[model samples]
Target: MFQPDIEIIAHTPNPEKVCTAAVKQTYKKMHAKELIKNTSEEEVEKLLTNIAKLGHFSTLEHACFTIAFKDVSVLFEQFLIEHRLASYSAKSRRYVDFSEAGFVIPDYFEDKPEMEEKYRKCMLYLFNSYKNLLELGIAKEDARFVLPYSFKSSIIATMNLRELIHFLYNSIYGHGKEFSEIRKVGGMLLNKMKKLCPTVLRYFDILEHKGNASILASTYESSKSEGVELLWHTPSPDKSIAIAALIKSTNLPTALLKDIKQEEMERIIQSVVRSRRPRELEQVNFTFRINNVTLAILTHITRHRIHSPLIPSLASIEKSSSYVIPKGIKENKEALKIYREAFDRCMEFYRYLKSKNVPKDILAYALQSGNFITIITTMNARELYHFFRLRTCLRAQKEVRNIANNMLYLVRNVAPLTFKNAGPSCYFYGYCTEGKMKCNRFKEVVEHYKAWHLSPTKIPGL
Candidate 1:
């Protein structure tokens, strides 16, 4: 229920102040003792403008600011934390429980009482069901299976001057998509900064450029306008293509196999073995030693479809490309032969592994080279907790489970607040998404996590 604004108790990296001081030093260095020189503050502001045009960003980082933040959403909080240079504190879920917490109602939800009523009913149902479940011996862990992501929380963001400037650029008036609740707060904070350090905060003094400057020769150009700005993008992939090419190897004959090098025999052996698994899912249990080239191919192919691979590397591609339909005028059949042999060898091994009394889980792990494929998914505390609850289950893919586990290590250190209580169904979510397979011990899991990990705390005003 409490929505707060920026309360700057302190700050550093005052760019305007530093630029003014730096520019004035130019005079003091020259005059030394001669001139009773205090450069007019107007001169300082003008000098700061030119300095910004020169793109000296580091000078700005010297200025710092500490802000108090209150009442932000979990998603928005994560967005702030992702900006590493900033620090945060938020309200605790455990010590100060949300049992009677007042949550934020989205604009549209509040605008329509009927819609709000339905929404409140749903959320209340979830909370009450969870509470009742807890009272009825179903753990809070199990009860929380119904909670919605709209649950609101708050945080306090403490950042340096450079960061504060950056936040201002992204979230102020006259900015695009200023609807982000945090950005509005940022605008208010910037106003306060301008007041405390009038000469220093001159860079964000935009009226000079955006308004009066339009009475111009080249239209707001010659004088060079300025202020803070932030830019971000979904960066393009940069992994080397050569890696993909390298993975194209060993789907053929000339390549010497690590454990077996013979050509014709390995081919015959792998083919007969691989042919047995008719369905892609059945391939899940197949034992095949995928070479690096094969693994890379499988990586690209499976990511494209989430399907089981055929030959799983360059070899499969070559074999199929060669016989099924050939479009290229110059065909290198030898590469095709090597691929055939490698896959054959794998099929033979899979056949042997299947016949023996080996376990499905063990056989699944035995894959190397072509054996394992990894998916790159990134999430912070809240998201990671959700993923672990759903994906670390007995029903989740064995390989995905491994990935989820590995990611949890990074998640814990980076955003301790959100992830401290994150992990498998028993910990993050109650029971199972697959009802029949559920352990139904979510309450015990939540209590266990609560005992060990600190609940998130919302820091005031950023």
Candidate 2:
């Protein structure tokens, strides 16, 4: 039978009543008396059911469900974690030794003995290579570059009832219906949530997809490309909108935004911004679609949960052609030879496994960490400020640093005043924070972003 090892680890007690009480508080004005005392269970159920029918689900956010996943592939974790506004604690690959770890075998390989053997054999070989790299004095972070996505992993994901319903409705009954594994897990999680808050959970529309596989295949086709491409999906048209929003917050007429020149506007924007006053920048926004980046870089940027990332399955993007050879690796002829050889062997087995009709989910085990992926996300100016400061630091990974630098350059062009202060934390605070790990190039980092702010068009090589 098709089943995934998932359990409801913890959930809010009397979740329906809690949600109903929270919903009631929002509708009525605060009268100092106790609001939730002596409410009947039947009354709570009726109230929540009525709210559900009326399509009011904001109160559902007050209820949360935490679930534990076991014996699942790392690929699944990537997909599940894309549901932002959720808390996740997954076992770390960089720190955890997966040498002796077991993997989840998909039922797709059950009827085919040859493909199943190839999968098991490939996993054993990959794990041995991974362990050998570790034995060769390579760091776990580097050695993990050889690990496959199908490697079994564990994660505890907790989400509010509102997001949980959205995840279920989207993954199980909506766009994700074509993805069998996500559909299966989504169905199981949905059933679990209904048990905790039946009244609130009852209103979700869990309809299955009628689309063909071409719809899903097209996503994978777009996932792999040869170079970095950044497109501003929803850049603000002018500085006026941002200025108007901030002025509105101050209860001032938006017409004032028109009265101020660019120079005065920059001062007004800058005056409100401080290390502690970042929340004021939330009035501005930027959305981007970045293509052809390695999963290593994707892993780092996706940590900024304030934004929503729509990603395709890692299984589809796993290909030898999609692997990125680090610049350092490419500099050494022997190292480059060895790296290419390893990827060739990995893909050779992968292609053979695919030819045998092995499921793509299982085949993802043969993919290297350098595999390519595309990510589309949106972050408000506040989160972008945080992202730039953290990811643009000298201590951060180079690939994402390039990405962060490019993002800052693009945003500055759209709203120069709003993002005038965006850059590394050291640039903003006037001192390096990395201590001994610092690149000791504080002046250089500051000048680099200074050029970005000063430039009229896109900075070359960004």
Candidate 3:
């Protein structure tokens, strides 16, 4: 009995006029303010039609929309966030007690009463288990591991007209059309767009399918390895960063970069890094293949928006038996037993659903937040430095901190000078930025990292 509640909270006023004015400013000598005031409604509509025909959509970015979604599954939330050109504020599972949070029952169950009853029982059991973990003094963050992917969550997403159109195209006609929930939401948003900016929709054809699912289908492959593996990195990363920096800082010609000595390159890298303007670091990149990452931690890593992470489809079945158990739950015998039993029950129900031949998309709702997945991600040196600074901190979640520390260790081996002083904010800045929430283990952290820097191969425990 789950229904998504979607509302357009706000949108750019006079959206067509805004887009039309933006288009006109490019060709006309008149300022945007004057052009908007002078442009007639009919003229705006005609101009937008012409612009759409010409395949110029950049002006569409001038119009923005803020939409709020409630009573939607976390699966849909994940799909929504995959549209990178948007802003999102989602309800936090860590802080929220989802014991009473409802879950989605896919349309596939409507025809089969017996299957629906079994599915309901499984969902209730998972929720009860989650609540029991809380009653046993487990933190909400740790207890959320037992929650299923179908659990209802809320999100407020904002996107410009161009991105919104792209999002709707995907949801309605692209790869997202395979999912019923996405199609429903896309239809609702399209209706709103029709009313708000009919002129824009008239020229924009939704039937022109933009998805490349067929072309990309053959490239899919299962992950064959585990843990963090540095799949690839830019060759001579330190030199790449140093060269980019020298090009910006010195008056020396680009031709002389080949003549520069290693000592001079190292000096330039040090100067650029210490200057605190690390844009040059973006010249180097690293790609990592991390396996067995929990859904909870996946959310944590994806929030760092500057990187590109390729995750499996939400409908895809997790083949690994691996799942995360927080230290708090593992240390308590009763909590550990409850946590393990919850996963076992969920998996048992999953197998039952699979035996019934339910589509993987519908069956995927049975997956626990603790379920593991493999992801491939690429990050530039600058973003990696930022990622390491925040995630390597003692304050960071243990699983993420471990991954961050490992990645830092790996990169330091190849690009030592670029990440020479990389680590937690305290270790990098010589002071904790968390104020009252600080870990107060400054000396321990500094000494550990200092040892780590000197012996790049050795990752000493803090």
Candidate 4:
């Protein structure tokens, strides 16, 4: 019987083991000989289970894994998206031509013939309705906007040792199979981790024990409190502070600016860029002009600061993005228009901004890296305001949370670096930061999150 939700495709060596190896290697400074060298797998596993004090973590990035997901519930899909550092490419709802559709039939429904028939009818009707919406010229996004999250989705996610540790810990220690029939799935993956990466996998086992202890303790407390159930929840809503949209447009195109230079097109554009006789700046007199440069100017400022490290190092630097897209060698009208508009505007803006008596601080923010044209964004590791204000909120977007998750993994890999014991407040404290604290899985959350940062295979502490 097919389950319509939640399945694991693949994971790397046990996360903790990778981490243990990484941490150990960073300090050891030797090529990673298998931590289980000269030892049997059973012996290695036992050692990992007992001797977890070797807190080194330097070579974790060397080991990574990619997991393929399919037939996931909205809850599970959302849960995975919270891990940002993992590379993902999901089937786009916008472009997928689902003229014909498919749906998974659960075991329970399959067992009940009548229910199965009803479910099948509903799926057909929903699919037809979606097709009809498209036929009516509704944008794919708007048409899909109403679709249920229960619909199937497939995503390929790439994870390094650090992230896998985080994902494994959370899934094994924190999550419950919402449908009650998928617990064995976790065991299957856990078994795999236990073999290939004993050191990291051992951490999962320890967390499992810790989780059980918590359950028992909670049960005892509940028993004393006359049969109260210990329920978990998300944190309270933040007060609506209307922070202005602080979007710093960088030297990036709104869309991925493709290099569409054909032999002739390249000759023309390059000629335009390096003209022997440059055109004089003649300001066209138009009072009604919006001076669209306000936002563009600000974005360039921030973008330049981010890419500065790719050229030179910043002490406050944590990490930078690799968002560059080299232009394509094709010709299209829109592409040509964009090339002309972007290059022209950028040149004009440069001259205009320079002519003005702009302040040094704002001017410093403008322009971009001389090379590497991707839309680079930088995060200052020491910037407490960024994390404290953003990561703790339940209302934060999922993509940002995933980014935060990646940041947490990277921080832990570098030990006592900017992100030590990193994560949402749950990792550092016994409770959620929100005043109401709706998600009661604080202990569970911390245990799950710690696996990524404290894997046995990676270096112990870097």
Candidate 5:
């Protein structure tokens, strides 16, 4: 059995004091040496309390916490690393021989003996196979392809107080509560943080809504999604709002936007967006819901830190009995049979463990890498352009490239003027960024996008 733990290995001494000093320096324009030496703890606390009360969190960035977690699974890594502003050092599956690593078991099946037996047998088989493959001279990276997400891994993560607070609030109060794993880890981190700086964390308690927790549980709990689906929300129904916002940087009067004709508005948007000035395209925000993507693909997409993603437990993937088979594998009969058999065996073990009442957390390791999961994420027009440029390239992973292509279609359908010039880097920049890795089919890619943009009712060819 694996026990997960989080230890605050290092943190700024007098964090509140440091933050308060920074606040005072910014507000009073005090000399750093003088401020650091003379600012009393009481004065710092008073200022920090006010800053929290006023919802000013940026000053907290001056203070950081470095935490180390042991016996946790890579399944939790996606959540921790999603905070792009933070720094991380985690145990890598590619380099580590996880033969000795323990596995996590969820509390739900603690009392179920039948389920426990099934789980033990399955895990034993998988681990034995992994060790055998090693003896057979298989690379750790390739052998690890069969390892489960439940395998215990360690990480030393560092985040500024601002991101820490955000992580805590979102975990305990918002969408984070939906996943039991995140809630457990969040509770542990919060307890540790409160001991370090009760004054700062107290702000969250003060801001809590009357029934926020109950509301989130009722709304988000028990939800599961499967297979590749792309959904968009809150698209600008009228392009004028985006056009006006884009021109707002020019300090133009509000009345001027109304006076501008549709054609002129179109011209302005196309010109600025096509110019590749992403800062200018930041005027509009786009939110997308992506479902049924593989866990591997989620890892790839989450690298775009500027975006926000909400993903369910990788554990829930078992219930879906779903997995993605790549095109090349599917095209060959023997290969497809072998791929399906592997997942089938994995699923059989997964269910055996469940029936025996094995801990649900440990069961996640039985999930195949190709298991499907969901992500509801958002990116502004600027980041969208960047995402499209990178992910839509031929050199990108096949799964994410498909996602990017769909995202392009969705955004273009709603805000054609804003995304008229958005696509792969080669198409957007008039040249491939991949250099020697270039697909050299830039012309064909451009023609495909052109045709897609011209159609009002046809699906784009991938």
Candidate 6:
């Protein structure tokens, strides 16, 4: 019976006027400050109306909205975070105790009393197992592996008008249309926008007819795998990076790069990457196929925006025995028994729901935090460097840190020179960034990476 509780916590004051002034500054000689002062209410409305009609929505980016969502399912949370242009802060299952957290009952169960009872029983068992694991001295982070996707979560998200419009459009007419929960949330968001910005909603009809074709459907065929695999990368990534660096640093013609030797390219790559701002590294890109990634750790990777990660839809979640057990839980016999039993019960419930032929979207609620998924992501060299710097640190979550280490190993093999010094901040900058939370194993960590830097061809143990 859970419903998403959404509220607009804050928004730009006089959003229409702000957008109008932003639009005017693009064409008029007056600065934005003067334009805002002189623009009348009627003028603002008329200008925004025209701007919407003209499909010039960049001006809309100036008006931002911050929203809070409560009692929403983790499924919806995943859907919302896919809009990478926005900023989001959600309740962390890792730190928060969810033993008593209520769950969402899909609308399909409203009339089926017996089915609803069964569903409730299953949810209670999962929550009870989670609590029992906590009592058995399991870390909250590990105990959360049994929590289903239906568990309610809270999130605060900020997005500008341009991205908001895109998000709404997708919710109504694109991939989000496949899920009832997403549609309900979308309707609520649209209602909020009507009250907050009536002028802009007047032109919403234009968006309705405009099809959102960004969602693609396809079937992937691949062997079952675990760990990160380098699928593809720019051809001759080292040369690509070196030439880009040369173009930025010198006025030399593009053809002159052909004369550069392998030794010279190495020197150029080392110098550019070691610089304070290595913008040239962006010229090279790498795509990785990461398998057996738990949903809990997936958030860690996706939170690093500025990359494209192709994740499976919630509806695609199926019954599987695949799940992750943290090292700590594995070491405790009592905790390990409870953990395995919890996953077994969840999967057994999933099969029962499958026999009922419930919609896959709702059935996805059976998925637990530790359920394994495969995803493909592409990142530019600059962003990869940033990703490694944060996720390869000793303080990072163990699962994600392992994936990051594997990725570093792969990328270093192909573009050794470009990523010569790529590693944790301490290794890259020669100092730790974690203040009081320092791992205090600086010498050991530095030496570990130093070996990889010196021997890029060797496969290091993850």
Clash totals for all candidate models: 48, 0, 0, 54, 9, 0
Q: Quick one: best TM-score, which candidate?
A: 6
Cα lDDT of model 4 by residue, 71-136, tens digit: 653323434554666767666554685546354444554556764565455445545555665665
What lDDT does candidate 1 reach at residue 203? Answer: 61
Candidate number of the best lDDT: 6
lDDT of 6 by residue, 45-66 (tens): 7988887788888889999999
Local distance difference test values of all predictions, in order:
0.40, 0.70, 0.84, 0.39, 0.70, 0.86
Which window of 10 residues has the lowest lDDT sum in candidate 5? 214-223
lDDT of 1 by residue, 165-252 (tens): 6666545532212233445556566788888656545666442233221132321111121211112111211111112122244443
In candidate 3, what are the lDDT values of residues 102-155, reduced to their tens digit? 899888788899999999999999999999999999999899999998899899
Candidate 1's C-alpha runs over 4 A off are: 12-19, 22-40, 92-96, 109-111, 129-146, 172-183, 197-404, 407-462
lDDT over C-alpha atoms for residue 359 of model 5 = 48
User: Model 6, stretches more than 4 Å misplaced?
Assistant: 208-223, 457-462
Tens digits of per-residue lDDT for model 2 on 97-214? 8888776667776787877787777767667766766665555555566667667778898998888887787776565555566777888887877787776666666222334433
Compute the lDDT for candidate 1: 0.40
TM-scores for all predictions: 0.40, 0.83, 0.94, 0.40, 0.75, 0.95
- State the lDDT of candidate 5 residue by residue for 388-430, as single tens digits: 8898888777678888887877777787677777788877777
Error (Å) of candidate 4 at residue 66 is: 0.8
Where is model 6 poorest over a 10-residue stretch in terms of lDDT? 214-223
Question: How many angstroms is residue 396 displaced in model 6 relative to the true structure, after the best TM-score fit?
Answer: 1.3
What's the true lDDT of residue 108 in model 3? 79
**What is the TM-score (0 to 1) of candidate 6?**
0.95
Query: Cα-based RMSD of the predictions, in order?
Result: 25.0, 4.0, 2.2, 26.3, 5.0, 2.0
